[model samples]
Target: MMYTQEQNREVEKVMKAFADYIRDTQHFDLLWSDKVGYVFLDGISEEHDDFCMAPIILRDGETLCEEIIYHIACDVMEEKGKSHDLRLCGPVEREEIQKRLLPYLRQLPEYEHLVEGLFEK
Candidate 1:
């Protein structure tokens, strides 16, 4: 769904806040996707924008495309923790945990209302 101007502003605020938090605490740089639910971390070289959001990458087609595109803040705490540790040390696992955290991050209270307001049908 296309976002209204007010919704866009709210989402931008949330994105900026979340991005700042990630940068400050986790030190991972975030790049947002034009698609609603996708954001990528810097230094991870991936050609396609589709793979940018880790959780969406891990999801099955329908769920990934539908759920992630709407709610992008569900797993902030857990993803942030993992990303922070990964940034400080190194790659701990072969699989990207951040992608798996996308849905959860979108579920966050701070973001849930925004998603509902902006994307809910």
Candidate 2:
């Protein structure tokens, strides 16, 4: 799917914000509950299910929550969804995510190596 120029800009902005957040903490907890089909970061736990484990992705998700960036981007896209456009959904394809997200993350030194293994072969 091709994103509009504005959509691309928003995605970049949100990803940069997340990168800044991670840089500040040097740690993040991303949790997903298959039972609830809910993926969220640390603070939203109270509103959701018991997300005990990190998401299992093609990579070692426990250490690299790169999927979280995609999920959060999907949410942002969904909010910006137009009446004429398809509603953005969860589990955005790994390739699509890597295309849209990785470049911004790679710009940050700390995230350069961390996101390397996030994609599947």
Q: Which candidate is the best by TM-score?
A: 2
Please list the residue runs of candidate 1 whose C-alpha ends up more than 4 Å from where it truly belongs after superposition. 25-28, 34-121
Predicted candidate 1 versus true structure: per-residue lDDT over 1-121, tens digit per residue: 4445655565454444455344453222444456653343433334433333343221122222233323233233344453322223223321233344444456443533333332223
Candidate 1: lDDT of 39? 41
After best superposition, candidate 1 residue 40: deviation in angstroms?
4.6
Instruction: Enumerate clash totals for all models, in the order shown.
Output: 11, 0
lDDT (tens digit, per residue) of candidate 2 on 1-121? 2445654454344345466544443123433354542233443254356444454322232223454553444434544452212232324443454556555565544544433443321
Show where candidate 2 strays beyond 4 Å.
1-16, 19-49, 54-94
lDDT scores of the candidates, listed in order? 0.37, 0.42
Best candidate (score: lDDT): 2
